[model samples]
Target: MSINELTKKLKNEAYSSLYLLYGKEKYILEYSQKLIVQAVLDEGSADFNLSSYDMEEQPIEAAIEDAETLPFMGDHRVVIIQNPYFLTGAKVKQKVEHDLKKLEQYLQNPSEQAIVIFIAPYEKLDERKKIVKALKKQGEVIQAEKMNVQLQKEWINHASKEANVKMTDEAVERLIELQGENLGLLIGEVNKMALYVGEGGVIEPSIVDELISRSLESNVFTMVEHVANRRIDAALRICYDLLKQNEESIKLMALLARQFRIILQVKQLKAQGFTEKKMASILSLHPYAVKIASRQSRAFSEEELKDLLIRAADADFEMKTGQRDKQLSLELFMTGIHKAKQTN
Candidate 1:
């Protein structure tokens, strides 16, 4: 099931014994988790009923043991096992793998008294694994995809509403420009803006610039989005305007280079178990950039991306050295993208 479906089920009291939630997008899945927790366990009783486990650092069997033993004075229990990919590796103790099938049997008919949730983002679920089959039959699986510029706008609107803050479209655009387009950074920036602006939700460009000095989902980031998405014509226009407005060519290239570098890093980071939010911070790129970069990275073959990075490095070298005619090279570089011929 999708996050929407899962949310609907939990909201409607359609409880399941097990839930498998994993994806590039986490906000919606988090919402689903909360809804499920709320539905199955009372707010006042949450402390006793909810138990979480970090299987990457520990054993899944230990968590299962905790689940088997019910909470005191609670009608139902929730056990969340996170990052169990280690279970299939040699690093995992043999004792757990030998009894993996037992976990499957439990999922096949999980106790009515408990709700089990597994979170293993950025890792594949090997259906050949014993528990995977039972989960398919017994629970809901939710895949969360990260947001892009368009969706970023929707998120901004939603976040402002949540914070009881108001934002102008220009302020929203400006905020995104500074941050890049990652939902986490955008949300964080918006929260800051909301606080500074007295929760009036009144966001102006000047106030936005002052309050949330860091945002990845803003207009300049959108400008880059137009280029990476291969809306080259529109991107060219934006580029020309930025130049006209005295935006530094070196700075622009730095921005472009940072964008592509993040794309490459996001691809690798996502593969290495880095969460979307963590990838942005570690890459020192905007979360919004990481969000789209991860998706766009799939559009290029690993070789293509590597080649593009080489091109960016060359462009950066020439442009910075002033060894080449600036406008001509930058324009040629922009046009060169069409040669790649990939439409995002």
Candidate 2:
């Protein structure tokens, strides 16, 4: 099932017997695990119902033995197998194939007082193995992996809507700016903002400014927009602000390089019979952002974009180890972008 499906199932009291959460992203899994723990145990006695099994040293049977036990005061036990290195190797599963065969039986007929939670990084799972296939079929598995910045925005907006608050456009943008691609961190920030604003919530930019410290994302995007508009002075000011915020010159060069790469992709896709929506899907970008980026790509020719990327790489190298002045190297990058804009 998808992550949203798992989340809805948890909310609807539709508890699965086994919850196997493996992913590039752990935040969603952790959120669902907490929901399970809360559903099975009261706030006061949650500690009693929650228990962990370490699989790095213990065999799979240790977890089975633990699952056989009952909850102390509640009707269910929240059993978590953490960092299970055993699930990764083929030989280990081969040696314990019979031992794991019983787990399917248990899943089919789980004890009334038990809920098993399995967590491992997705790359660690041996997908070809029998036990792996069986476990996938036996329970609801969630892949809670890392998403891009635009996905992070959707998550923030959805999370806000779930909490019964309307996030202003600027507010949502500010949240993305402060916390990039970390829903867990965004959740924390949202909680604080909700409490800080209280009822009749108005999540304005000022409120965001008061709550979240400005981050490198705002600086990065502002620099990009400034360059796009041919505001070299404003771009230089933002670069100084980045330097004042202790951002390394090489880091700025790297950010510029990444932006140029995206612009190149935008230009290429626009030429290759791709619509903006198709470009968004292919690049995993927000529709609005794809539109803006496509327009921005019109401001530079492909050859000019290529030269800018090369200049960015040279600036990165010079800023990192060359004997030239660091600020001067970054200034040269800004001027190059300006030159490229003029030529286009």
lDDT of 1 by residue, 129-232 (tens): 66676776688777556665557787788788879988898988777767664567778888887888876649889987676654322444555567666787
**Candidate with best TM-score:** 2
* Tens digit of per-residue lDDT, candidate 2, span 1-344: 77577667777878876878887676777877776777767876667777787665555676776777877877777789876555567344332323566665676676667788898865568777666776788777877766766667777777776666777988887677655556788877877787777755777878888898555755676687788889999989989978998888878778778877888998999999999889988998755456656777877889988888888877777877876788899898888778867865
User: What lDDT score goes with residue 329 in model 2?
Assistant: 92
Best by lDDT, which number?
A: 2
Off by over 4 Å in 2: 1-14, 85-105, 123-128, 145-154, 168-180, 204-218, 281-292, 339-344
Q: Which stretches of candidate 1 lie over 4 Å from their true place?
A: 1-5, 26-35, 86-98, 128-130, 165-170, 197-200, 204-206, 215-344
- For all candidates, the clash counts are 18, 1
Judged by lDDT against the true structure, how good is candidate 2? 0.75
lDDT of 1: 0.72
Error of 2 at 272 (Å): 2.8
Q: After superposition, how far is residue 125 of candidate 1 from its true place, in Å?
A: 2.6
